[model samples]
Target: MSIPLAERIRPKSLDEIVGQSHLMGEGKPLRRIIESGTIPNLIFYGPSGVGKTTIARFIAENANMTMYKLNGTSASVADIKQIIAETEMIGGMNGILLYLDEIQYLNKKQQQSLLEYIENGKITLISSTTENPYFYVYNAIISRSTVFEFKPVTPEQISPAIKRAFDLMAQDIGTEVMLEEGVVEHIARGCGGDVRKSINTVELCVLSAENGAKGELLVKMDTVRELTQRSNMRYDREGDEHYDILSALQKSIRGSDENAAIHYAARLIEAGDIISLCRRLLVIASEDVGLAYPMAVVITKSCVDSALQLGLPEARIPLAEAVIMLATSPKSNSAYMAMNNALEDVKNNGPLDFPRHLQNKHFDGADAKVRGQHYLYPHDYPDHWVKQQYLPDALKDRVYYEYGENKTEQAAKAYWAKVKGDKNG
Candidate 1:
């Protein structure tokens, strides 16, 4: 029932803030902006527990504006209207700031609703989001606001905050609180630059420790390890960590490291990101495994089906099997590269015309020879293969797909060469 340690030690002033010296430090742009007493609509972009909301609160307090808070997830258009109405009642918005948390949760329609209010100076908006605001926030809102990126709080910055939490706890409980050697460092390093998490972890450890004879709580290293567990894996599906995990998984599979692939797959599974894993697996099967192992596509597709149907812990079985198959399969990016090269040409050239013989046959008399329909069927040839102009005139001699070192691709190259020779003869 007591206030959380994070809330109790929340920095009331910029000096009390432990990290983000880049912006909160002396003579920084943000510090100067605050001192000028002219707060603009702003965006604070960063990861969770990195003080995005705290900074917004600091701005509201320092600016001395009548501030209203809205959470983008639960608050609706009605809420915005209510805030506007309330602001109007309180002397028509001479100085007002609306602090919106998780602003990326609002859809374009909801974000668009704020433009008029923002333009008319009914309220100065301060928005916080874990996502890159440029991608998730409406462009209009982005254009009107100054964006400040908040980085992860370092271990040194968090250590002092952790010690402060202990001091506050001791004062509250009327007893001395002590930590075993290295426990603080363990937490500071393991928290991964999250001050709020470090504080909560220390609080949990303190609460779990047994009281001493003189009524002191002693948190030992084992208690710290037990309560804190291992280092928390930071993941936000809409944030940078999502792409990082995907990249790690793909590289592991491409490098034929089955163990690493499975490890990232497990991370995704634990994060409830099975769909992204399935999507990336399908791409890997076709892009990396290509003609070197055509069956890889079939295997991965089956795994995807099984995963979607089975789901969760049971689904991990097929997902893991597919990961191993893709990792162990011979790698080739020929198909992926070939398509990209061809697409680049198409995009740059603005859609070249197709060959006359290859044009779509839709008219009633489309097969007439006079209509340029003298196309030879491959079935009429010796090996059921024939050479014809399949590419446009400009790219007739262009070679998009190059054979890889795999036996299957080598055999394909040989078959194509033989077909060309027969046609020449």
Candidate 2:
């Protein structure tokens, strides 16, 4: 059977592995661990398609240790026990190494069983997980394992890997594929540092190119554009996708599209965007719903506080309630628009001078310089009504707030009209 392109090119040695130079660099902790020849039970935590498995294989090969591999997704407790027994019976100079991939899938009991084995140090344990171990692994198992975090592949690191792949393909196809400058960087960035995805995308693009008829098999920007346009929408913990979900939620609310709002909320919940969901709702309540529905802000704040108190799964309920309530409520963006308009004026035109009479009198020269400057104390006037320059001279006629015509805002408008006697009088 022919080996697949991805596997056929898998790095057989550390030098061949792309990215993860931090761990393999001179005097790095991982390098030290490998040199020591006796490694503590370890957990390799990172996103998928980076070189976790490759690094594990390199360690096993270099150490010349008896290796046993198991997928945590499929291995049962019985299988693990049997492997443990078999490992002990193996008569050889090399010690045993157990590599468990996706170890977070193991349940509490299975994790406990493995923890016991790791504690005894009879077999060295190295587990890989795409999930955050703190949430998935039992404390006992985590305590026994030394944790190593792997970062996503950077553009500079991925450049060489792409070049290496192109060179390999060139040998077989008898033609050079000339990638445009920064094309690989763009692909690497679009892949969001996923080496496996980057390599596969390049492979597909190269294969799609014309057969040996050109001066160079050029991978154009258009190819990358088309590839990334249809690429899977992935949620990266450290990337812009995290904030993109929040932006979508806020826009949906602002646009008054309840269905879109709810859909974005669901996406955030599914993507584990709990803290972000709570925070955005809190702001929306105060800034969008505002006094029009005072209770919305109250409910949103309660949801945020409760989520912080309870934490995930259970916390998701209060979060969902806030999302639904905010979505279904009478929508308004007046407050948001008001603040933004005022902010823009401030940023572009700079701060305006406050009316001297309204300035604080606590400072040394404030009382003498700012007192009796024709200030109208509204509380001391009839119906607490007075016409005074509340805004600065530069912004006297500038309208900042445009009240929504909701029931609550209309009522507020009536009260203000009675007080000011400016109700179309």
Candidate 3:
């Protein structure tokens, strides 16, 4: 197969790169590193098509050292050893620059094989991973490398690359190629900040377009939409990026940003991971919206059930409802915090005996003193409540649940205060 347009048009120099201005911008750390001509062991971390591979290519072309490229998914120990063996021979001469892509796929042994060579400066390593390096790459590799993050290009940032690709396509066809309004922006926005994917998409649209009068290629909006229906959105359910979406969704809800919450919810929905979305929404209801709006837990449960029953497209409706409710709802973490605090004590302090009155009567042996004695049933009292020491003796004075500031929690707090006869409560 011919090389993909993304690879064909890949940036050869830092100047042609579309995004990651943070690292490649003027006087940026990476630019300075490259200009210094004394490259170090480096790790480029980010989603795909954001210039990790491009930067490595640029370095390989510019650096004086003999460059070797390997993909971690396919590169073996033998492959690494061969490179290292070669590097050792060339060590006192031109040196070696190794560009390893998807470095997270390299297990410990394969990664360790390069360590001695890298440490000795026989191999200048440039590794890239779509995963968070700390989570996936070995600690030794991380400690030895300076990490640069590549963020997705904004639509505006991607526009230039899209235009450049269109120009190239026109040249290939040996005719003028005219673009309909919004065609460039459509491709730019559709790739989810992926420059390579945008180029691929541009090639697809150009090839799919119909020839107009005078033998000119006319790219239209309809053709762009038809081909780009499934825009590139990087989502790995097991990866950190997926969890990031869940975190953003919950935080937006907790922060009461309804629009932001809806946006994240929509992203998850588009990713077609209803089960994860349902599970996270349910947790958010309890963990973030707990006690302040107690009914939120129940409502979220209902929404989750409806979503499961309805399935995607339709499922998104109930999920959107749940997300909006959570974002706009009064928020609190009082119950969640109390449970966590109590769990800490339970885990660290070890199991302790329950209060005599709270212990199960059946568990009481001839030492029945530990149960069934002086147990005052609350239902027999007015308001169906009574003050009793429910905590173990050592923890009897410890307070866990602090009432949240929401009106619902405040009212409950006031009622309990009256029942306890705490005048200052």
TM-score of each: 0.66, 0.57, 0.66
Error (Å) of candidate 3 at residue 72 is 2.4
Tell me the spans in candidate 3 whose CA falls farther than 4 Å from its real position: 89-92, 231-251, 257-263, 272-425
lDDT of the structure predicted as candidate 1: 0.84
| Off by more than 4 A, model 2 | 12-16, 89-93, 212-216, 234-425
lDDT of 3 by residue, 1-425 (tens): 17777877887677888988999999999988888878899999987778887787677666677888899989999998888788557452677888999999999988988888889887899999877789889999899999998887899999999998988888876888889999999988777677887898999888888899989889999989977765553332323245567779989999999999999988888778777688899999999999999999999999999999988789999999999999899989999999999998898878888777765664567756444467889899877777788888878898899999999999998888787785334
TM-score of 2: 0.57
How far out, in Å, is residue 156 in model 3?
A: 1.0
Cα deviation at 245, candidate 3, in Å, is 6.1
**Model 1 lDDT tens row, 195-236:** 887888878887788888878898899888766654354333
Q: After superposition, how far is residue 163 of candidate 3 from its true place, in Å?
A: 1.0
User: What are the runs in model 1 whose C-alpha is more than 4 Å off?
Assistant: 15-40, 91-94, 131-156, 230-255, 271-309, 325-425
The lDDT per prediction is 0.84, 0.76, 0.84
Clashing pairs in 2: none
Q: Candidate 1 has which clashing residue pairs, if any?
A: none
Q: What's the lDDT for residue 120 in model 2?
A: 73
